[model samples]
Target: MFHRSVLVQKVLEFLLTADDGVYVDATIGDGGHTLAILNAAPKATVIGIDSDKSALETTKERLKFFGKRLELVHGDFENLDDIVLGQLGYGSVDGVLFDLGLRSVMVEDRFRGFSFKKPGPLDMRFNTDETLTAYDVVNRYSPEDLERILREYGDVRGARKIVEKIVDARKKTPITTTEQLAEIVVAGLPQRVHTDVLARVFQAIRIEVNREFEKLERGLYAALEILRPGGRLVVISYHSGEDRIVKHFMATESRDCICPPGLPVCRCGHKRQIKILTKKVVRPSQEEIKQNPRARSARLRAAEKL
Candidate 1:
């Protein structure tokens, strides 16, 4: 089943600045937020894009009632500029949303190998057509590279020890299953953090397999450029790393200058492009989290083009 959208009410309040407008649901997973947008703004049109064709198909079916108001595309948000240009021809969008969280349907599919609880091939590509997979990350990556991903992507402590265990296990037999990798991770980490570390390790590999951070950075820039003046950009991220990137981008873009404090004159000449709507990152209510536990980690930030 599709999990409920995170911070849907906040999204609508921040995003629906114009009664009739164009919006982009950059990671339109299962169409939860997109559905809400269409319902809230009767005349608004949404360009829903996702790397997963399966997700697009499901959203297309679910949103068919809206007819041409919803256009589902099988593509990554990293190329949002081109996709938006293709649709609008010569203009900008009123709002763009990036909800960087996996859909519940994808995680529940054992064949996709997204969940550690589901024992299946270690293939965690958001787009199955992509060449890289979690299996390659675990079995083929060097200890140093593995350690770097675990440290940077997962915020995993004792990443070297975890990498050592993975390297040792794969040496005997190729680490081929999500269960195998999770078991190794749980064994390598301390008892106190075993559960959390196991999940982070899996997350690190999946992020690497999908090149999530890199794509996210590119997508953010594209989204900002396509937004018209006063247009809103709302992003909901589920991990600290993703949240950090979004926060930094909004903070940097909202400032007029990026020069060092000690500098006498501003050399960067950076102009402020956006104004932050949320003074602080927004989190889901406890009641919402109770209904959908996956919404617990979500952090939402919104900005308007200046």
Candidate 2:
């Protein structure tokens, strides 16, 4: 089974409004958070979106109880505007939830190659239809491109050395599997380096293959644009990079002016779009983490549209 929803109670409390409304589960994975939302708001309708067909299938089975109340869409959340307008028509959705983390299904399915711990193909695409796979990245990318991805996406240490190893290994034979890539990364780094080095390298490759950061920025802006005034936008991010983007986006949108200091007059004319609800980022409780270790890294932030 996929991992349990992270920070469920908190998500429910912050995401649900007093009256019933439509909500969008931007990264509806296995529908865990979607299920929570539906349960919390009986009259609410949810439009669940995911890039992975397998995930959508599993979500369908799991959320079958909701029937017409839950509508599953096989698409990326980055196209939130198109999906929302196509399905529910224009204007107002009460809330949008973005849970930006790999579900257990992705990591546990060896064929998907999301986890280096499992030996599998070097295909780390969230959507199976994507042409660029980790195999292509590892075997075909130039050393400079490899280094750039490792540095910018994974923030991996010794990125240059890792890329050197990758270049040398592929010259001998194509790197076709997750294990092969992990071994190459490990072999290139000093033995003293933590095992996490391999994970970071894999993360970098996955991020590149999926274009996660680019999609995230687009999706967030779309979500904000689709929300009705006073509607809520909630996001649960698993890493510092993702959290930073969400934080800055919400902060920027919540402010009345983004003009540089000492601008003298209000020439920017930037009106506040949303109000930050959680003054501090909300974290999963120790009890929730103890129950589901994966929730340990979750940081949730919410804002209400103005």
Candidate 3:
């Protein structure tokens, strides 16, 4: 079974104040938050979007009790304007919830290659329709390209060594499975830091397979555009790379003049779009983290459109 959502109560409490509001659960993984949102406000309508078709079906099954109150769409949240706004005929949305990172079900599915602990196909595409996978990346990318991805996406310090080892191993025999690729990464790292290093390498490959960063870049802008003037944008990010972009957008979008600090007059009329609610990111409580270890790294930041 998939793990319970990380911050259900906190998210629900925020949306409760707005009655009969329209909400969007961008990464509606299995509809955990979608159910909560519906439960909180009976009049609220939720548009749940997920790129994984299987997960969307599973979500539909789980939320069948809600009937017409919930709408499930088999599409990426990145295309919010077309899939959500245009189709729904809404000028702006009331609340937006983005649960970033792989869901529990995705990680558990060995065929998805999201977890290194299991031996499965090296396919890490969240959409499943994507042509590239961890298998394609490992076997096709140049050593330099591999090193760059590991260092940038994975934040792996031994990226060069890991890339060299991956290239050498693939030349001898194709790295086809999660176990095989993970073993190669483990072997390349120092004996003491093998597990940590292996995880970083795997994460790097998964990020590349999904074009995760690019999606985030486009998605955040579209999300803001689709939100109403007083609407809220809630984002829960697991990694620093993802959090950096969210934090930057929240700050930049909320500013009146994005000009350099040394500017004498405010010439760039970049109006403040959103009001950042959390001065610092809100993390799960100690008790919550103790119950769900995965919640330990999750950080939540919210903003309201101006």
TM-score for each prediction? 0.96, 0.96, 0.96
In candidate 1, stretches whose alpha carbon ends up further than 4 angstroms from where it belongs are 87-90, 188-192
Clashing pairs in 3: none
Error of 2 at 6 (Å): 0.2
Q: Using lDDT as the measure, which candidate wins?
A: 1
lDDT of 3: 0.86
- Clashing residue pairs in all predictions, respectively, total 0, 0, 0
Candidate that beats the other on TM-score, 1 or 3, i.e. the better one: 1
TM-score of 1: 0.96
Error of 2 at 154 (Å): 1.6
**Model 3 residue 287 CA deviation in Å:** 0.7
Report the C-alpha lDDT of model 1 over 119-222, residue by residue, as the tens digit: 99999899888999999999998899999999999989889888888998988999899888888888834688867887888899899999999999999999
Which candidate, 1 or 2, would have the higher TM-score against the true structure? 1
Error of 1 at 293 (Å): 1.4
Worst 10 residues of 1 by lDDT: 187-196
lDDT of 3 by residue, 225-249 (tens): 8988888889999999999999998
* Candidate RMSDs in order: 1.4, 1.5, 1.4
Stretches of candidate 3 off by over 4 Å are 188-190
